[model samples]
Target: MKKTVLPTMLSFYAPDLREQIEALPEGTALIGISASGQAIAVDLDAEAPHVLVCTSSGGGSTTVLRSLTAQFLHQGAHALVLDPKRISHLWAKGLPTATHRGNVAGIHDALVGLGEELARRLDLADSELDAAPRLIVSVDSALAALRQLTRYWETFRSKDDPHTSPAVAALEAALWTGRAARVHVILDGTPAPGVLGAAPHELFGTVILARVTASTWQRLAPFTGPAPKPSRHSSRGHVIQQGESHETQAIWMTDADVVTWLTDPDDPQS
Candidate 1:
């Protein structure tokens, strides 16, 4: 008798992935292709609002960040990249509308500046924000940065200062009030409860889980309903938004591909 064989689910990558990127609707960024051959994307303005990517080490979170950042930047938004490890998203270095911070001190300063900017925007009317450029803060590793920031504050905080780190407070503020200000954050990390002053799902509108276990999802994103089973295919994950789960294979982006977005003269066809 022949042994029973189970068919493995195959991941799809478009041959014209760049074209798919070019064709993304305004305010939407192409994330990847779904298992059923649909383009998976996130709307920065409305649907997603803000994104939190939860994945284990080497789970391709940086790739997702780069793809999203490239599209947002192409659409005229500025980006602030907080990469304490200093290795991810090297293509962003020296880009005109983008700034990269590698050290914990610099990351803290950037977050503080972002908080201040968010406050300024909150004072403006809706018409003013309509003409204002959007801002994306891409944190490569939220957990690591939070740990470093806590230690940094502990070492240098004055007695008069509050016990909690101001940087963390600023981040929490942004999470709470940034959408109306056109300031959005795309964070990739394994964050625990209380780290962000709320549950992960509460802080971010869109949560992308990559190569994470079912328990991780249940704990961090119970609001998304039951988690998808683990897949043998690489680059597979679920994008949970508005209570629906969309299984997807994340877009594969090379550094060269991302650089074009920075230098391509704002023309998608160019």
Candidate 2:
């Protein structure tokens, strides 16, 4: 079988590209360009509410999350980023619509807060009330954070507390219920054997592989058919959905670009 390849560069600053992205539907965000030069996008409100990005180190997983978060913010949504490394997506640090948590404690608190919000939304749903603005929780290095969270709980739990990590539990609940309430998670790394209940394919509606390999595909996404080989071009990836893979170039934007996009009120179209 023949394979598709992506362009060497897909500029986020191109005027036409920017226009197309802005013109996307309320809940849709442009992710990248397809192999045939079409604009590839995902609709969080209806399709693929949560996305999992599986990739090796330096394989552009962070780039995918950054692009999605920026688009979500631009669409008048709120973003919560749990980055234990404290280095991914630094552009979101001081943004008004974004909340960044780098430490294990902060990440735990944020997850708990989301759980509370989810409860409120569930209540509103029961009453048929309006939902809040869309919330995108992007977890950078999610596996590492999960491990650290487990250790943190072990060290800090009281005698009467439950054995499982509250943060993880909350996250699991969100995975099951948040789609209806417009709360979404964008996990930037692959899940471990026991993390997230080990059903990543069902939990994450969409999956993107930046650096594809046979073992990784079978482990993280067995139902997606044979894994597409890694693209020769760096930053290229595939978005697998419903047993089909769409070859695409990962969108790349500099930290300064993100800052300008957030702060420049005069250039709303920019």
Top TM-score model = 2
RMSD, every candidate, angstroms: 4.5, 2.3
What is the alpha-carbon lDDT for the whole of candidate 2?
0.81
Ten contiguous residues with the weakest lDDT in model 1: 3-12
Per-residue C-alpha lDDT of model 2 across residues 1-270, encoded as one tens digit per residue: 344566686778765777787788777888888877666777776555788898887778888888888988988899999989998778888999999999999999899898988887877753453436888999999989999889999998999999989898888788878886778999987776565665777777678887757888887677767877787666688887666678888777777777787789357544
Q: What TM-scores do the predictions have?
A: 0.88, 0.92
C-alpha root-mean-square deviation, candidate 2 = 2.3
Off by over 4 Å in 1: 1-14, 223-226, 265-270
Q: How would you encode candidate 1's per-residue C-alpha lDDT over 165-258 as one tens digit per residue?
A: 8888887777778788888889888665675667776667778897788788887678777777766655567888777677777776667767
Local accuracy by lDDT, each model: 0.78, 0.81
Q: Kindly state the number of residue pairs that clash in model 2.
A: 0
Q: CA shift at 11, candidate 2, in angstroms? A: 1.4
